[model samples]
Target: MGLYDRYLALRVRTTDAAVPEHVALVITERDLLEQGAYDTLRDFFAWAFEYGATDVTVYVSVLDRAAAPTLARELEDLDAPREVAVRQPDDVERADAPITVGIGLGGRSEFTAAIRDLATAVDDGDLDPDDVDETAIEDRLVFPNDPDLVIKTGAERLSDFMIWQSVYSELYFTDVNWRDFRERDYLRAIREYQDRNRRFGE
Candidate 1:
């Protein structure tokens, strides 16, 4: 670690506030196409775990569906700190790894798929329409784990990620692009999250 990185880490460690256990990052497919993007991702995972995050979810939004396979392959091959499970938009199974990379899976499509599954269960007499609750919907979600904090780089908008799960998560938006993202950026997000008084919608 560099001197500035060490200083940032020290600040985070000394903070009395709680660190987010589950962290989510929202980036675009174009972001990964940039140079050093994969290296940044590797460092990001290490930094998150070092700071207190146990689970890290990465949502890669792709404008073209044709690019999904290529993006998934590249992300899956990334040298990360933990196991990575890369899934496409239509994937029904839940990701079981510590790090999950969703390629071209928008939050709206994920929710729609979950609803469709719930409807199927209802139609098959397996689940009553009235009995279907939040738990049922969550059970059908591909990535059901809720994150404590969500980070979005290069923009303030959440690129259609974790709609159901990130309902109560603290969001941190940075103008820095993914390739330019450094340890300091991660620490800044952590510090921002730590300083927030999370109400979880009261």
Candidate 2:
């Protein structure tokens, strides 16, 4: 067996958990930028598309200095059909395929900052109560969407991954680092997710 297969075998044998039918992965731009692996992100997203991902949303926080527009532009330039999209807050367009790629403005920040920004805008008269019809300051910040499961591999801390969307998402953490993340490790995480009862605030 290949090394990855071996790891999968071990996990499956040891972990008596079930596998989830649908799965979504959230990767931080820090990891991608640090490794200079924009291609890796592209490949992973393409794979996810082929893997029957009903919906795929990739958020590029303007707040991240490492993932600057230069790098994003370079990566977007190399791709074939331009499956990747560069979108601002108001430019969201619906698509045909179940899988879609979108860019948003914010990441794992407490809505505290967002609230404060909106308040500042209101107080400074940049935005009036009547002027806030369709466009509002809150529209710029990215909020986490609740996923059925969230898996964080590598590193001990939460890494400010998903603050809002993961409120009820089942979290499965592993010491396995990102570089070493193999298919088996992912399968194991899925199995772990399947085992959860997920009462979901009942």
Candidate 3:
């Protein structure tokens, strides 16, 4: 490891701030089009796990729906450190791998679909309206785990990621583009998260 990277690792190891077990990353399709972007993503997964995150969620926002399939195939080809489960926009199945990648899956659409499923269950006498709480909604989401920290690269806008899950999660935004992201950048994010006093929606 580089001298600066070792120093950052030591800082994280010595800090009192709680390390986020589940970390989420939001990037755009355009960002992936850049050279060496996939390599950065693999490094990101390694860093997250090395820094104590057990689960990593990656959301790749898409402007053109047609590009989703191509993107999914490429993401599946990534040499990630952990098993990766890639879900497309229309998929309603739950993902339970250590790494979950959502390609062009809009958070609003996912939430709306979950609500629709609950309503259908109610009409079928399978569920009661009163029991349609947050858990009910979460049970149907593709990526249901609420991340402790969400990182958005190259942009500040959330772009509709994890609407139901991230209500209380701490968010970190960086101007650095995905292709240019490095291990040091990930460590910097960890350091920044350590400095925050989270209120958890208080």
> Clashes per prediction?
0, 1, 0
lDDT of 1 by residue, 1-202 (tens): 7898788789899989999999999999899889888989999999999999999999988889899988888888888999999999688688888999898888899999999999899999999889999999988888979999999999899868889999999999999989899889999999899889999999
lDDT of 2 by residue, 24-83 (tens): 454545555555355555554554343334344444444545445564565457463235
- Candidate 1: C-alpha RMSD to true structure equals 1.1
In candidate 2, which residue pairs clash?
144-165
Off by over 4 Å in 3: none
lDDT of 3 by residue, 178-200 (tens): 98888888888889988999899
Choose 1 or 3, whichever is better by lDDT: 3
Q: All candidates' lDDT scores?
A: 0.90, 0.51, 0.91
TM-scores of the candidates are: 0.96, 0.55, 0.97
Clash-forming residue pairs, model 1: none
CA shift of 54, model 1, Å:
0.7
Which has the greatest lDDT?
3
